[model samples]
Target chain A: AQSVTQLDSQVPVFEEAPVELRCNYSSSVSVYLFWYVQYPNQGLQLLLKYLSGSTLVKGINGFEAEFNKSQTSFHLRKPSVHISDTAEYFCAVIPVYNTDKLIFGTGTRLQVFP
Target chain B: DTAVSQTPKYLVTQMGNDKSIKCEQNLGHDTMYWYKQDSKKFLKIMFSYNNKELIINETVPNRFSPKSPDKAHLNLHINSLELGDSAVYFCASSQVVTGDNYGYTFGSGTRLTVV
Candidate 1:
């Protein structure tokens, strides 16, 4: 079985400040990692994904994440953020060889202010 | 255009009433999924269909049934809805890219409220 844990339930950052949302996973097999962002009253949008190669993946809206296999973690980071960046972010995992079902984390609420 | 779309953006109904939410994906993807976001903002997979065949069915009760008539459409029907059933339901689609599974395109979501 695969599970995703996003440690930060809420992260408050001032505008133009850097932020990082931590996500860790536990799986017995190889898995695919992804970060999804959901704006207020909107569905989730795919931020980025790590399938194979390139530990670092850049996503939309100037967000990036590094996949650390040894840490069993994929943490999303941004050098700077705007007020519009406030949203709920989810970390998901899918087994590489088994079903393509996505197991999502509880979510991290990113609150950016000026 | 919206790639994955769901009908009834907001549904407010009484308990014991059965309602259905429809979902459609224009993208030529082989997989479709239904996810529920609870009040705590936890997204959990309820069901998944691939090419009109059921593939993943979580521990959801039988009252919550999913119908996939074809590869592009997946509908969820909730019978005897309870207050706990009040949540945001999302529809998503995904496909293979370069021999690996890619991320999903999600619908705006349907907010169901049972009073």
Candidate 2:
């Protein structure tokens, strides 16, 4: 079985400050990783995905993540964040065997203050 | 147009009552799924349908049934709802290609409250 763990339950940062949301996954074989963001009372939106190729992948809203196979982690980072960036971020994984089942981790609440 | 949409954005009902939540996807995706988000915002997949055929059914209670009339729609019917059933349910769709599948497009979600 595959699972995702997000160490931080909540992260507080001031506007224009940098932030990193850590995510770790457990899988024996290769897996696909994804990051999703959900605003208040809204569905989740895909932030970025790591399927193949380079270790670092970039996505919308100026967010990027690096897939570290040795550490079995995919951490999301932003050089600077805005007030509108406040939302719940989730890290999900799909084991190569069962691509249909997406296992999501407990979300991390990103609270941006002014 | 919304890629995925779920009806009854909010549903509040009493325990032991039965209710259904409907989902439709405008995207021509062949697969649809239902996910439950608990009060703590943890998400878990409940059911999945591909081309109106049941494919993946997690270890969910039998009281929670899913129906897919067509490839574009998947509905969930809950029986004898309990307070634990009170959570946000999300509908999502995706197109599966040969080897790898794309990411899912999620609906706004239905907030079900059982009192």
Question: What are the runs in model 1 whose C-alpha is more than 4 Å off?
Answer: none
Error of 2 at A16 (Å): 0.5
Cα RMSD to native, each candidate? 1.1, 1.3
List pairs with backbone clashes in candidate 2: none
Highest TM-score: give the candidate number. 1
TM-score of each: 0.97, 0.97
Residue B42 alpha-carbon offset, candidate 1, angstroms: 0.5
Candidate 2 similarity to native, TM-score: 0.97
Please identify model 2 stretches exceeding 4 Å from their true place.
Answer: B98-101
- Candidate 2 lDDT score relative to the true structure: 0.94
DockQ for every model, please.
0.74, 0.70
Q: How many pairs collide in each candidate, listed in order?
A: 0, 0
Per-residue accuracy of model 1 over B28-90 as CA lDDT, tens digit each:
899999999999999999999999999999999999999999999999999999999999999
